[model samples]
Target: MTVSRARLALGALILVAATAVLTYAATVNVYVQRLETRLDAFGEVADHPVFRRLLDVIGYVRRFYVEEVPLDQLLEGAVDGVLQSLDDPYTVYYDAEAYESFEISLTGEYEGIGVVVTTVDEYVVVQTPFPGSPGATTYPDNHDGVSPPGLRAGDRILEVDGVSVVGMPVERAASLIRGPRGTTVRLTVERPVEGAPPQVLYFTIRRQSIEIPTVQQADMVTPRIGYLWLTQFTPDTPGQVREALKRLRDQGARAIILDLRNNPGGDLSASVQVASQFVPAGPVVHVERRGGERETYSARGGGLGLPLVVLVNGGTASASEIVAGAIQDYGSGTLLGEQTFGKGSVQTVYTWEDRQGRAAVKVTTARYLTPKERSIHAVGLTPDVEVPGTPEQQGDPQRDPQLRRAIELLEQRLGG
Candidate 1:
């Protein structure tokens, strides 16, 4: 009886080993088949020298490497290698954190320092600060608390939370600066000086929901004229504009100044919604895709029919350009200030991988044009009046002259 039991135990052990080996073999086969399919998709590149070199490197690492390699990391590295070969700054892979940020940015809702930033000459510069933003109420506090405390435009950020941003990529640096609402971030900034070390500035900012104050309203001259600054056409933009209009009307504003300066843009639908408020039923702007395909966007509603003037500048890009271009094309309002920031291409972001977090890619899908089919990409929308400044000439008052010009134009049209 003991001998029979031992034989059965040995047989069971052998069966278990066999099953394990078969399962591993099946998994390997499946991976191999998928790899083969991917290679087939690159059929035409079989003879390419660069392609062959990549394959050789991958094989060498897999076979002769001394340390164990994680398959997912290896695959990600390979994918990055492929994208790098494209040589396009706009075409690159987004890791998990970047993907999350990209998603939030598209929705136009995120918790951060509440500052829009852009890379300018190897340094990140503040584009605009949303109203009620931590930085807005914090750093620009004068002795009276009624005006700005000397922080001006074109300020270059040197550090965040005392960490140097020198060697970091602009995108990475931006991500670091942004965090959940209520978080505080101190910054060291160089005030666009000819040669000076960054000034040590501290800001204990409380992060809030950051609903993106797309529009701001003020009685420009009180009871006579008012100003409405539309930073972007976000999801909540229409309601904000409506609210501002109501406030402006309450203040007895006779003429209106609509500021679209430095607006980078937002949802296309939002642009249409905002534009609809100004013009009668008319086509505002047109969208042109690759291969000569086109579509037109028009206004369908009525709005405040006061003497109106729209302000624009060279930093007005994308959906901002759409609104400016539309107003200019339809003759709904006079465009003052400098020509717009030309970013006519529309992009679509999609998640490319599923891992611990999501990563995405934003691809330019189409080009936006005016109702007259005027290109607004490299060809910026020229304002009726131009404001010239090159940082050195105009200094910190880059858009002030332009704003003055718009206000003047609106006041004149209203016979004020």
Candidate 2:
């Protein structure tokens, strides 16, 4: 082709591309303008300074930015910024992944290897492996073909699928480990051995639908005292507690020790049910909404009528606090431990969807109070018998001063 003809063709191509870009930009601007007008019809939202400024900034970025910006990302950032500005830690916006996990948590089930972890010394450490879970079967020596060795308690999670999680929070690490059932997640773990260097190990675990048990350990601590360690309040917690109580009663238990240590609370309804098991028929907790609205949760009759003592610590929060507070206020049980975590605000999870699939907004809807009308918001509940928890006495019940004290108290009550 002639040089002049070639130059003309290239100029035509450039013009067509520029025209297409301009047309697309105009279309987007028109769409946004229409949306703004429609939203303005609702109220003062469109005229609000913050809303106007956000739109202006977004428009500017779309027009003059060095690179193309995704509208979805900008919208998500705006949502996040608004939530952050509220300054309420409990009020949060959950993206698609987080929302899905939240729903799974409510159901008391999820697809994971079934290992409960905690952040300790800047490392994600396995606190416990659920029995029959892949983690429970995973051991250094056991080499089964079907369910290979899984995670062990005290194992330091170093990496997940080649990504370093050395200083990652346990929650984040747990989310990464959880996936659709039958999928595999590779983990690099470091296990400390007694009087030897730490051992590095690798494992590929297939995730499965794990049913989280709310009642962790239930047994007779003594001849007449039963110990029920409530892990967290879940949908099945009430049934589990009821069954445990029946078994304990059948075994000739006259007293009970309800352990709520390190338990981050869950379902509110479950908490009420558990508290009702020990307290007489009356108001267990009161939920007070904004503008002074209040709702009372009354306990149903049929309490075990057994002398009870509750164990709590700084980690006892939310729904757990509801149970502990009710028990304390009603004088149904003796509380023994440090002050509670003091999360007295009630959150209602609102789920919705947009172009970004599913999302959730967990907003603080009300402030709950004990039957005695005590709002333990920032100030936690002070135990009747104050006992401190120490890191050294974590696993060893013999060294657990708090447990020993509880047993002692129960023994005295039983005159044993």
Clashing pairs in 1: 181-207, 182-207
Clashes of each: 2, 2
What C-alpha lDDT, on a 0 to 100 scale, does residue 162 get in candidate 2?
93
Q: Write the per-residue lDDT of candidate 2 for residues 206-227, one digit (tens) a residue.
A: 7889986788888887789888
TM-score of each: 0.69, 0.69
**Model 1, global lDDT:** 0.61
Tally clashing residue pairs in candidate 2. 2
| TM-score computed on alpha carbons, candidate 2 | 0.69
| Model 1 lDDT per residue over 1-416, tens place | 25744443333222111111000001122234334544454444545666556555655676689987764566556655554444433344567876666556555577776666654545766655554556555653123444343223356778888788863445667787888776677677665444776444445566666766576545545357778888677667877887787788788888777877656677787887788887767787777667989878888887558877787765576777777787787777888766665667765543433335555444455677787788877668988767654222111223356556666677677673
Runs off by more than 4 Å, candidate 2: 1-41, 111-174, 177-210, 390-399
Q: What is the Cα-based lDDT of residue 411 in candidate 2?
A: 84
